[model samples]
Target: MRALIAIDWGTSSLRGARLSVTGQVLESREFARGILTVPPGQFEAVFNELFGDWMAAPHALCLISGMAGSRQGWQEAPYCPCPAGFAELGQHLLWLQADRIALVPGLSCMNPDTLNTPDVMRGEEVQLFGALQLAERNTATLVLPGTHSKWVQVEHGRVTRFSTFMTGEVYALLSQHSILGKTLDLNGTFDETAFLQGVDQSQQAGSVLNKVFAVRTLGLFERLSAAVLPSYLSGLLIGEELRHQNVPPAQGPVILIGSDALTLRYTLALRHLGIACQSRGAEATWAGLHALATKLTNKP
Candidate 1:
């Protein structure tokens, strides 16, 4: 029941926390070095540098979830097929450096649309489990937004199915690389009005591809300022992503888990579309890691 080192190591960054048995975070730290940046076989070294001060004792266990379990990470922890839960995840924990450290296996499920095409996720599973726990719901639809947004459906405490969206990635590519990139001002502030305008437009006729061109025309006519175009573009992408998912409003409040900035836009967009939403901080990942750690320690 001693404190555990919970690390959420993703592709771009690493977040670590020391959590007591009761799941209270005692100390935490973040590092810019994600799995991609960590040199081969140096995961432990980097982990130590970021969290050595809290190691305290050899008995302390480190539980990692994220890209660290990826093929290019410290070890390739195999994906556990869905309908998975904490028990299934516990059964597949990959031990690294003996029982002192472990990696939480990611979950895999068939693409609902393609049937045979597999879709997988690493770190977000932990967050989903945590979000489920925080919501205290046995069934719910959860949304985790980031570079790649995820819409996951959980039933009876197990993940039934989920889908990923390239909303953020698409927005970034369009705003920074595509023809729309020229008029965008990355340093601009968020404009709720302009963003809502895009959300409104998303509901109207026209494909997202064709609609994006309006960013240029609007800016050309001085109707949408560079300061607010970013928000509008964000709304457009998120709105379309949601619209495409076609999640019924009857699913109740969609549980949202992620940073405030990203979730804020999603919340606004979802609300504008008349969908209910509830939110929790990223600490859900810690609560989830702690839950799994408890299971691991109590196992015979």
Candidate 2:
């Protein structure tokens, strides 16, 4: 493959990397200009302004992943249904410039949960592939924690199915706008003891709906300090997410892909439940894109 430019353009931020032939990142840059911040029809202008020189490399190929392909993004790249791997995604790339640039289609699958709703992930599919490549494994369960967390199951290198959770968004709504927000000291550092306390409490036999009210009552009664309640609430929600997983003991450590702050909390929660896990971050995106570029180059 020639010089590769990988871009992860998500809701709130955009990241780009120029990679060596072997997939090592030679140069990288990030901007706050995500699709949400870009005016309609200006994506190209923004892209060129931010990364024009990078694209000037001879025969440079760019593969963009994430919300840049959403309906509101640069161009809608129709989703590729599961089970999909590098080849499927490569075949579905929505080309912007013949072979020079394209968007990596996201993945879609029926929810494994009750109701069987359709689930999808944009940027995360790249991270999943990257995680698999980095781990050098064909089968594993991976989790990407964020506003909408995903639990993905891979079989023989393709994403067979996955599920999403609104843990982070719920935490924000509850801690910022809900009644529980009244007493939360939202500015304090995370308190490990309080967080573990919430995690332990979530393990008890009861619906989370009932347990969440405790956040309010615990604060009202001063049983828990207001400053640490946010961490405690975080534990309860994250712990609930962990509790619902039916991860088998033989699938190996659950691969986590996300930022350090989010992954750290997940790591703490998983270990608290005696479940083994491993984590990857930004590198996963670049690696995933590089892998896709390589596959596209070697195609017969």
Candidate 3:
């Protein structure tokens, strides 16, 4: 039987899995992928080291997603346009070596001309598809939250268009690394009341961060604390998300895939906005890997 390998190579780590044609996992492993933390220029060596045991096997077919196809990895593949389905990925394939290896291109959105801007997602495509498969429907909405959160809209088994919120990364930098970081408490939690307040402020403001520090101010004045951070953060994101609702969908379901805590917070905020959102937990990345790998191999 041919072995299918799926890799989710991100900014910080590399996750790979071997699976049967039926999408059943055989083995999986992870390796540090921080371009800086690992060898200066030995991605292939590091990948080989981590998956060597699995490498010595039957017919090998590999499909990679994420930073592995970045400018630093094997080869950077181009981004495929939206309204993309399964085969859409097939078109953007980048050969890492030969028939034994290929990388799926990331999803690109927005018109690049006029400097309108663009948002690209590399590794989340599989998760979106897997979530759609689980739903087994023609249309679905998926939220994959991380450093940069993206809300994907999939229809007819194709990724039409999506929106990205630099929420998480911005929050991290401001709350932990920037000058504003110095004001955050180590054990802070989400503040529900402050969250709604922050959401209101963000929605009415020019810049998202224009009033982010108010959360801290409310806390320092003995008016807020641990319970407000999450809520405040949620509000900020929720407020931003609302901007996209020029015309709301028929009010269908929202499937969030990511860490439990993060998605749960999104669920809470969406619910507060009167939108029903279900938390799907983090999509099994390894399972997602196998699904893409199997698709690429054209195996049942």
Candidate 4:
């Protein structure tokens, strides 16, 4: 079993792992540089600097997933359409610098909720497949929360459909740049009570545009303190996202995959909405890359 180098490169950061044939991470490295920051044609230079020490052998397999395969990244690995799995994705791998390094293709699907509009995801497909493997479920809904959160439905071992929500990015903009920021204190503690109030408010009868103004009004009126405004805003945004997206009632626990902080808030929001959810750490990416690597390695 040859050791494998797995890279999860994204818009703002790069993470690499050296794994045993059995999927154990033997060593890992990270770089603050993302595809957006890497100068054109300098990807290999950056990769060399980061992984040169451990490239080890001429035949060592380097598998990368994420924005590195985007049109703006090192090389554009065209997206594989939905109803795809490791086999379909493996066939589209873009080889770079000889056949030693390969970039994984992202996935795309027709947005079921939005007519004629398509939704796409990079890096997360790997994580979704990994979650599928980890849970050993034939059918499940995976919620990966981030700047652009994803709600994906997997059935019969293939990703059939998924949708993205700009929950995190929107929250960031409002909390840092909007009029709401004028009176809000982002450095305050997490107030679960205020957060839940926002979640509950999301269900009320009014447009989100109307409700968000309350963030300002409540603070100005001293009904909602500046200290708790951040949490309240967070909850309101997440709650509205969940409500608008129509997160289905759990057939089973919704698989929540992400870092602790993001997943914790999502879990809280889901429970508040009476949807069952279970948390899984980000290691699903490793498992997914391993699965893809195994498929590629065994391919004739």
Candidate number of the best lDDT: 2
Clash pairs, candidate 3, are 189-226, 190-227, 190-228, 190-229, 190-230, 191-227, 191-228, 191-229
Candidate 3, 1-300: lDDT as tens digits: 357777788878777777777777667677776555555468778878777667677677777787777777666788888878878777678887777778888898884432757778877887777666665655767888778888877777788778777777777776677654445564656666767766666667476655676656666776656455646655775667665543245636887888887786677667766776666643456556566655666734
Give the lowest summed-lDDT range of ten residues in model 4: 244-253
* Cα lDDT tens digits for candidate 1, 1-300: 768999999998999998877999888888888899999999889887888877766588888999999999999999999999889999899998678788999999997687678888999999988888877876888999988899998888899888888889999999999888777787998889989999888878889999989888888899988888888898888888888765656666899999999889889999888888989888899989988888888888
TM-score pick, better of 3 and 4: 4
Total clashing residue pairs per candidate? 0, 0, 8, 0
Candidate 1: which stretches are off by over 4 Å?
56-58, 248-251
Best first by lDDT, ranked: 2, 4, 1, 3
TM agreement with the true structure for every prediction? 0.95, 0.98, 0.85, 0.96
Record all residue pairs in model 4 with backbone atoms less than 3 Å apart, i.e. clashing: none
Preferred candidate (TM-score higher): 2 or 4: 2
Give the per-residue lDDT digits (tens) of candidate 4, residues 146-219. Answer: 99999998878888899898989999999999999998998999999999999999888888888888899999
Best candidate, TM-score-wise? 2
Off by over 4 Å in 4: 246-250
Q: After superposition, how far is residue 120 of candidate 2 from its true place, in Å?
A: 0.9
Off by over 4 Å in 2: none
- Please report, in order, the local distance difference test score of every candidate based on alpha carbons: 0.88, 0.93, 0.70, 0.89
